[model samples]
Target chain A: MYLAKIYVTYKPSILDPQGVVIKSALERLDYQGIESVTQGKYFQVQLSGADEAAVAKEVEAFVEALLINHNTETYTYDLTEI
Target chain B: MYLAKIYVTYKPSILDPQGVVIKSALERLDYQGIESVTQGKYFQVQLSGADEAAVAKEVEAFVEALLINHNTETYTYDLTEI
Candidate 1:
């Protein structure tokens, strides 16, 4: 089996209001020296396949098709054997 | 400056409905060999501090105080100089 750790984040040009809100909240709570915050989505997926190559291929296809909005976000993944 | 890559995830004992939904959706879409799915929150935080150790200490305190629910979620972070 292979495990894929995927992260999907907004493009650099995209404005992340949630992140802005979080930063403000942290400041309000008296957390100092916080420059910025960016929020993203993380997923861990387990797949059973014949080999690492095949499993990685499947993960890439499924992640692109179902996990993210290609127009606004980009995704990266690390596949590890389990 | 430091970049803290943080991840907040539900405890293993907790049931993740969102993950279940995603797995079902993937199956419906004919994606195979899916064993399980777990969804989590990711954050990239920029902090300015005198040193790595100090920044890490601040991150730990703030993350524990605000980023996660102690009963259901757990968090881990990687701090890197930027």
Candidate 2:
């Protein structure tokens, strides 16, 4: 099987309110030295049979259509046979 | 500076509706070989002054309090000097 680990995050252009909140919370914790915090979505997909290229193509389409908002977020992924 | 990459995922015991939805969509696309799909949250945190160990410790507490639902999810992280 192939395991695809995916990360989907807000584009640098997008404002991340959740990240802001978390940063504020860290400030409250006295955890200094935090420059920025960005939040994102992750997925672990198990595929039964596919070459890396095919899997990558399908994953891109899947992520583009469902996993992320094309206007606001961007994604990247890695796949390993398991 | 330090970069913390964190992943928070659902426990196996819990049902993942979004994952299910994605799997079904993949099926609809005639994208074969997908056995299972699981989804979670990811975070990229930029820290300025703390060493890796101290950052890891504070990150744990931060994630526990705000990032993951401790009862239903689990988390792991990696910190790199940047």
Candidate 3:
């Protein structure tokens, strides 16, 4: 088995309103020195596979096909044998 | 400056409906070798601080205070100089 830790985040060019709101909230709550915050999705996927390469390919395919909005987001993953 | 990469995940005892939905979607799409899926939150936070230790302390504080539900969620973070 293999475990893929995937992160899907907004493209750098895109503005993240949710992040801005969180930052503002922190400020309001008296948190200091907070420059900025970017929020994203994180997934841990377990797969039954024979090898790392094969599992990685499957993860990539599924991530590109279903996990992210191509226009505004991008994804990265790390696959580890389990 | 420091960059804190934080992840907030539901405790193992909590049911993740979103992850189950995603797994079902993938199965419907005919992706094979499926096992399980767990989803969580990721954050990239830029903080102004004198050193890593101090910034890490701040990150922990804010994460506990605002970013997660202590009863159902837990968080981890990596702090790096930027």
Candidate 4:
């Protein structure tokens, strides 16, 4: 088995209202100087019977096919042996 | 100015109920074989007059001080010149 860690975040040019809410929450809690907040998804996938390079390719394709909307979000991944 | 991207996540062993909710959501959206979902926070901070290494140290300290609950969460960062 291998561990595939993926991070998905909105494009820099996009407006993120949820991020805004979180930023305000942090500020209210006295976390000063926090200029912005961005909400994103982190996923840890367990792979079976796949090599690292192949898995990376497949995962990227998978995201492009179904997981992420490439128009609005971008994703990156780190694959590690388990 | 520098951009400090921070990711705060729960310890692996902890029970992630919100993650579970998201997992169910994905499944309902036809995302198959998603074993689990883990929720986390992502923040993009604009720093003033702090070098990469110094900003890293201070940000780590800031997370320890206010952002994360060390007992339940762990954090990491990537600093980039912007």
Candidate 5:
């Protein structure tokens, strides 16, 4: 088996409302020394019978095809044998 | 400036309850084709005046000290210049 860790984040120039809300929430909760927050999503996927290169290519395709909106968000992945 | 994208996930041998819950939720919400799901945390940090290596070191320390539990979770990061 293989494990794929994927990260999806907002494009640099785009605004992240979810992040802003979390930052405000943290400040309201009195978390000290916190300046800002930008949030993103992480997904850990388990695959069966796929080699590293195959899995990597599949993951890139998956992200591009469904997981992320390339114009607004970017994604990357790390794969490891299980 | 530098941007740090950190991904934190549950250790391999450990169970991921959040992931399980999300998987169930997705199924309930009529999202198809999800066999399983493992959830994780992602933090996008904007750093000023720090080089990539230094930011990497500081991020490691941050994750070790506060972001992740070494026994239960592991983290990796990607640094980008902006």
Candidate 6:
């Protein structure tokens, strides 16, 4: 099986309330010098295939088609054999 | 400055509806051979510190204190100079 480690985050133009909340939470917790916090979704997908190049292409297409909403978010992922 | 690439995923015991939905969506799109989907939060934290070891220690403490809830999710992070 192949494991895809995906990281998806909001575009710079988009407002991320979750990130904002996390920033404030850090401030409240006395974690000084936190320059910034940008948050997104991370996923681990297990694919039942063996062909490396073919799987990478399919995964990219899959990401572009369903995993990312280009209107607000951007995503990047890596596939590794496991 | 240092950049901490953090990934926080739900505990295996927790129910992940979002992942379930994504799997269904992928299946609907005919992306066959997807064994499973698991989702979590990813963050890139910019910290205003120079010392690598001290920064890593602080980042760990920061993650434990505010970035992760010991109740339902687990987190792992990497600190890189940036």
lDDT of each: 0.93, 0.87, 0.92, 0.71, 0.73, 0.89
Give the candidate number with the greatest DockQ: 1
Across A3-69, the per-residue lDDT of candidate 2 in tens digits comes to 9999999999999999999899889887777799999999999987657888778778777767888
| Location of the lowest summed lDDT over 10 successive residues in candidate 4 chain A | A42-51
In candidate 1, residue A81 scores what lDDT? 85
Chain B TM-score per candidate, please.
Answer: 0.95, 0.93, 0.95, 0.88, 0.85, 0.89
TM-scores, all models, native as reference: 0.96, 0.92, 0.96, 0.65, 0.57, 0.92
Question: Candidate 5 DockQ score?
Answer: 0.27
lDDT of 6 by residue, A1-82 (tens): 8999999999999998888898899988898789989999898889988898888888888888988888999988899999
**Candidate 3, DockQ to 2 decimals?**
0.87
Question: What DockQ, between 0 and 1, does each candidate earn?
Answer: 0.89, 0.83, 0.87, 0.31, 0.27, 0.87
TM-score of chain A of each: 0.94, 0.94, 0.95, 0.89, 0.90, 0.89
For model 5 chain B, where is the 10-residue window of minimal lDDT?
A: B26-35
Each candidate's fnat, in order? 0.95, 0.93, 0.92, 0.36, 0.44, 0.96
Model 4: per-residue Cα lDDT over B6-50, one tens digit each: 788889888878777756766666654455556676667665544
Candidate 4 residues A12-42, lDDT tens each?
Answer: 8988787787667667766545665677776
Return the top candidate by lDDT. Answer: 1
lDDT of 3 by residue, B10-63 (tens): 999999999999999999999998899999999999999887777888888899
RMSD of 6: 1.5
Q: A57 in model 2: Cα distance from truth in Å?
A: 2.0
Q: Please list the residue runs of candidate 3 whose C-alpha ends up more than 4 Å from where it truly belongs after superposition.
A: none
> After best superposition, candidate 4 residue B48: deviation in angstroms?
2.8
DockQ value for model 2:
0.83
Which is superior by lDDT, 3 or 6? 3
Distance from true position, residue A8, model 4, in Å? 1.0
Q: Please, what are the lDDT tens digits per residue for candidate 6 over residues B1-82?
A: 9999999998999988888999999999999899999889898889998799988898889888777889999988988888
Off by over 4 Å in 4: A21-36, A69-71, B18-39, B64-66, B69-71
Residue-level error in angstroms, candidate 3, position B54: 1.3
